[model samples]
Target: MSDPAPDGLMPFQAMEILKRAKAMEATGRTVCHLELGEPGSPPAPKVIEAVTKALPQAQGYTNAKGLAELREGLSAYYSAQHGVSVDPDLILASMGSSAGFILAFHAAFRPGARIAITRPGYPAYVNTLLGLGFGVAEIPLTAANGWRLTGAEIAATHAASPFEGLLFASPANPTGATVDREGLRDIVDTCARLGVRLISDEIYHGLDYRGPSVSALELTRDAVVINSFSKYYCMTGWRIGWMVMPEDLIRRTEILQQNLFISAPTLSQIAATVALGERDYSEEQKAGYAANRGLLHDGLSTLGFALGEPSDGAFYAYAGIAKFSNDSLEFCERMLEEAGVAITPGIDFDRVGGQGYVRLSYAGKRESIELALERMAKALR
Candidate 1:
């Protein structure tokens, strides 16, 4: 008899580590959580107040494209923040960037079409594409180039084995490698030249430390851009985000959202609209993340972890663990069990080259990061 099985969708390892940490905390053990890309801050007071007022009036599902109010706010956001004009009609609110990705993938590509993504990237990009019956080609980014993805690499990879789409992020996950404006332009032009549809993940946009993040909208109108209130606004649990779709993909995406998600949470859409005007709160949070980034980077270096490139954005420090161990999974396990510190294994990001690396998130409080450093020094060093 043939075995009945589902597609092998790998678990997101950061969540696995967080689960272990929570379990330890449940048993009276103190744990320093450095896993997950989640910011440990609460949502802005304005967001909370807005949602509180919205709950009583909470209505039914919005149109599949989301509320006009939310979509209009997002349109104004791109114009104000990125200096690029986006039509309100081109915007769609999503149940976090996860739904946005699913809708974009289905609308942008046919079944079995190949897409290019970076290694040491968000694991969901590869996993989601695979689960949807699409092929993925990974472009490896290394420390020699500050872990940045370049136009040349895209061109070369396509020359060898062509892909129909490119899914990319700046201030990338796990690594925090952000591409500058010139670099981003090169990548956009290259994708245009190659006729590869680009899907830009800009969830971590405003969290950049080095400089401003460049949006694909500033360079081209063809790319599908995704952003979330979860990161910048400290609204992860809200599960709300928005997408800027190319003209060609708008109707297709709208139809997909109708069938697949119905719409982003009605309450979240309302709250997210308020979030767009509360950048002051988000900016204050960014300053705290900047400090945490320094603390984690310096502390990890002191422990002989080789940190390549400045973590110019986001809140993670992806450190090479070759100095301590070769197996990142086992290293993380030992760290959690013995040191009471929970971090994600690099294998979660890069399947082939991740064995010698680990990703530590610095999105928590200053005291927690200090405690983690102290514990690791005593336990490992």
Candidate 2:
């Protein structure tokens, strides 16, 4: 008999909104999609060209850790983008950040080990940990603190009750809070002192607006750094991402990758290799997101949606909807049905405080953001 499914796995609610929006679109109604965090652009031209050219020979299984060339390319990328030198040997390409997370969590912590993650952060982190049978400790971050986690917070929480590891995201999902270099350094130091392993999610690294996103590799080599080509490379459907592991965890992660995912999609990896070289194309995409962010932020604020913290990076705006409704799900549904604009309820990210909040993704084009704003404004009125 199959084992019972883990109770900790939660459905991705934003996908539900997308489904409803698709249903509306099927009925010939135009829906302004601000719900899912998907980029509006396709893979860079050069990336597609490379993949198309390589497709004939790209079908074979690769090294479980991924292709050597891709890993070297990613290593070069880290050096160029973050000024951090990473050894290509330590990099493992995975299906996406989702698979990378599974590998990292499995390699880092044994089942039942306690790991601390921020509340109002990425739901996948909590859900993945719980599904792996790891104990999750929520570290509450508030708007007063810009929704960013500080080293002091980690140290204080560890002092009261120790955990085996900490997982954090800069340019975090749902809430677009990015931690500065100094903050990251302090947190790294705190983790070292407290004997907690650090897993840094840098998937949104290239999508930053305020400033460059900090790499945990810049602070320490001991931390596991996960990144993806999904967001910045505009290749979500390509299903390719990677991780930079410490020397110690390399073999463990390699073994896990071998068993779980043989390697990321071969053609996607080829595309990603070319994508890594397209700095100009990536920057152009980032520019689009920046413009959309500004338009959405101002428009939502004018519509009386209270933003908790300024979204420093990423394409999401976590806004307070308490004035409209305490139930974020209901609020988002009303916005979708009445205004023809789909958004995500914040409850997907934070179970406790999220009922009063909703997350809107501005990862689409300028016209879409503008249209979504207009629709939402009308609905709110």
**Using lDDT as the measure, which candidate wins?**
1
C-alpha lDDT of candidate 1 relative to the true structure:
0.90
Q: Tell me the TM-score of each prediction against the true structure.
A: 0.97, 0.96
lDDT of each: 0.90, 0.88
Task: Provide the lDDT at 85 for model 1.
Answer: 83
Where is model 2 more than 4 Å wrong at Cα?
Answer: 1-6
Q: Taking the tens digit of each residue's C-alpha lDDT, what string does model 1 give over 175-223?
A: 9999899999999999999999999999999989988888999999999
Scanning candidate 2 in windows of ten residues, the lowest lDDT window is: 1-10
**Model 2, span 63-113: residue lDDT tens:** 998888999999898888788888898999999999998998889888889
State the lDDT at 59 in candidate 1: 80
